[model samples]
Target: MVMRWWSDRWTQSAGAFFLEKDAIFFASARDFLAGVLAAVVITCWNLAAVERNAIVQASQKPYQTLSSRYLYKTHKAKSGRNIHDASFRVYRSSPAMAELLLFEDIFTITGIDTDGKKFDKVSRIEARSEQFDMQLVLDVNIDVYPIARTDKFTLALSSTLRLDGTPDDGVFDQSRKKSLADKYEYVMYGKLYKYDDDESGGAIKIGVYVSFGGLLMMLKGDKQHLGNLKLDQRLYLLMRKV
Candidate 1:
């Protein structure tokens, strides 16, 4: 399965960890196995990088708290097409903030598909946090349709962030260049996959949808709301410094 995925153009481009084509073109079984092992190791390493230490461990201590939120939206016509958007939020916040903002914030959105079929869009996010610097990390799993496509894939995304300003520094100020209003930048990465029932017998064709890169804005905020948070195929979110 790994070998076949390696041969796919999408997987190669998404992961981009394969050896040179010539190195594997006519390789022996031993070489193929080596390539598979290399790919697995590289993939795991990359995932760990995106997951970040904030998610797995925080300095010498576990995170003091966890906070999470989820938002899901849908738009469908009487035709046969539909658009769904969702986001999962996990950040470092005080236990009080987590309970006040997310613990009971539950709602659902329902609509009719283009085929006149009824569908429901439900989402949720949960985590814990602290007040000092707002150090945070998140792991998001989404099963939805990507932008400009008619199919759905499960996207696993993760990142880390920490608030570095002070209350007097205008954490909620939008006019200043370095204010909390600035884009919250982080390295974002995820893998995309499709469920296929083919000659491989209902195998899942997985590919690296996105790899590690920073300068990509993950979160932003105004005095009242976070903006420009539509990451990886329309994962929109709103946030505020608590």
Candidate 2:
């Protein structure tokens, strides 16, 4: 019944949009839409903090470095491919240093017209900025199914921390930063989602496990993790923030 209703609705919408007198209008609208789509930019939001906004902040110490490790596993698959597998670690080094360690691993990718294949690579991502700069830098390669290839581009990933409105004042809130620093050792879990065409595309969800609450809350790395997320795969991330 749901399928039938969807089909009927699509048919009706298409018919109405393509009515005999609507051809010219449809063409113009399509061109306008294409242009708008080209101009629209893609930004990744922090799903963890957004979804768990009601969770009380637990950190009260000064902002410091945290670390952890986990087994990275993929529980979701698409087309003719299976999930990927890997090991992750975040070392405890310095208060100013934030590191995400991704060990060597194999990932599966299924193309639009071909069988799935496996690719393996190693990488490390770190944020050295004392304040949020919208861009997060990392030295790593990522693989998303159907379009399997390392991100050879030398560009730092971008992140949007505040969800309420533009923070015209400053990037980091001192009180909030202190809370994160205090609770730096807390355990946190989050889900990463991929929205391909902004509001047009459905979300592709990925699970993330963080050992350090500061990583997810303080450094705000969760906001930028979506840069390497894939729509065709469900990623189970076991990560630490050090």
Q: Write the per-residue lDDT of candidate 1 for residues 75-126, one digit (tens) a residue.
A: 3333534433443345354553232221111211121132332223311222
Error of 2 at 178 (Å): 7.2
Error of 2 at 123 (Å): 33
Over all chains combined, what TM-score does candidate 1 have?
0.16
Query: lDDT of each prediction vs. the true structure?
Result: 0.29, 0.31
Worst ten in a row by lDDT for model 2: 151-160
Clashes of 2: 6
Off by more than 4 A, model 1:
1-104, 112-236, 239-242
Clashes of each: 16, 6
C-alpha lDDT (0 to 100) for residue 25 of candidate 1: 67
Candidate 2 lDDT, tens digit per residue, 62-144?
Answer: 22222222223222222534333333344333422232212111122111212322224322333323222222222222342
Could you estimate the TM-score for every candidate? 0.16, 0.16
